[model samples]
Target: MNERMIRLADQSGRCDLHTHTQASDGMQPPAENVRLAREKGLAALAITDHDTVAGIAEALEAGKQYGITVVPGVEISTRAGGKDIHVLGYYVDPQHGLFLSRLAELRATRAQRNEAIILKLRNLGIDITLEKVVAGIGRELKPDESIGRPHIADELVRLGAAADMRDAFDKYLADGAAAFVLPPRITPEEACQWIIGAGGAPVLAHPGLYGDDELVRGIVERSAFRGIEVYHSDHGPAEEARYLAMAAEYGLVVTGGSDFHGARQGVIFHGDIGSVTVSVDVLGQLKS
Candidate 1:
């Protein structure tokens, strides 16, 4: 964690804008994820599942039951300058036509890609079976849901093919790694436009992960992004400062979160909403 983030977490702020649930790739189910969020004492959260809002409804219901605020969301993967960029769309309309269609297409592509990955793993003598991976989706994941590498990684661990999620990815699943699968998707601008059409705030997620400063700035300048995710597990102090400065220059909202998934995932939240130290006022700015 960034030192400044540690200081911010100490300040007792409000809201964790990014989160995940089993509706996408998270280990926990929506209800369980919400319960953990409540336990963490977050004032607000967004279940930004990858390419689908399937988890949001359940998360929203769970949040309501637990007296926590749920901000409907999805994390879309898109290409910007030939590099993959993920944009988090928050407070989205779940029923948006284009959004749903695009997600459906992406999910279909994911299934095919997963099959290819499984075949590649098999060829590599990894002992990974597609049936095992499919079975690892858990009961809460939908039939039409996009299966992520995390599920595959978990299956690998379960089947003794790999030690843990990180090992599985490092050995096979990471981009450009052996058995890596690519999804056919739209550009980052299209993703931003899709989110805007869904009446949501489109924010670039983890700019530090892009590894290209010029590409990062170009994406921000070209897209209708409402915010930049400065607070993330991958960002260091220098990267956070750079992103926060960029956000300010672009007149965008600055949001942060624990990016919490569950226990199996390495990092855990130290402070509830206070972890990022972003003011509760950021939510108001998002609405505007």
Candidate 2:
């Protein structure tokens, strides 16, 4: 366990391990997310932006300024049994060569997927363009930010084709919807290996959201993941207990986070920083 992380956790009684920033689909920049963690009285915050570590540096800088501990992390999207599975990599080296190369390839794949979705939408007479979608999202797409269906949904809303993001996803962007495009696939095992290779702890993210305890169990049994996210904002009391039991059964580390995405989705689904409680001892257990 890192003594510094242990001390921080001991002081604040809470930490958020899963969070996003504008580097991906989140609404705020990394620094702002760190500042919010400080305001929320959190001892530590992890900037687990989707498939990218571009936000970690800024978050770390902001953490220093705000007196909060920033855990360097990334959320990797992968597939298993045709289902989307997300792996959270904590304590990652952002500059790892192989990791950087894989991220670039994933980003390129994401761009292609976005283009295909737009073409499908146009064929369905939605008449949307990538430029319009970018404009709708109100930000120039950064290299670190992978353009995904959320941005497309934003475009749909801007065009008055849908009332909101959820509506847009329901109508055209969700899996099996008209504009849906299958994402590039990587296995959960491969994802875990990558995280381990990068000298980080790989954790299964939001098992409850995926609706398959068996699949999560299969991954844990077959792969090298070090932890499970036991305290997600979306996890109910029952779900939390279930994962907690699983963690103990597997001898895996326990982690919790708000999955904060800022205001992009309107209401924050996970409670604010201090609200979702995970003890410092659990944070210590995550130390490599």
| Number of the top-ranking candidate, with TM-score as the measure | 2
In model 1, residue pairs whose N, Cα or C atoms come closer than 3 Å (at least 3 residues apart or on different chains), thus clashing, are none
Q: Write the per-residue lDDT of candidate 1 for residues 95-200, one digit (tens) a residue.
A: 8887798888888877888999999989988788777777766464576466788888888788787787788889889877888877677888888888989999
User: lDDT of all predictions, in order shown?
Assistant: 0.77, 0.82
Off by more than 4 A, model 1: 1-13, 265-277
lDDT of 2 by residue, 93-159 (tens): 9999999899788788888989998999899888799988777767676767777677778778878
User: Which ranges of candidate 2 are over 4 A from the true structure?
Assistant: 1-11, 269-274
Question: Residue 166, candidate 1: how far off, in angstroms?
Answer: 1.3
Q: Each model's TM-score?
A: 0.90, 0.92
- Looking at model 2, report the run of 10 residues with the lowest lDDT sum: 2-11
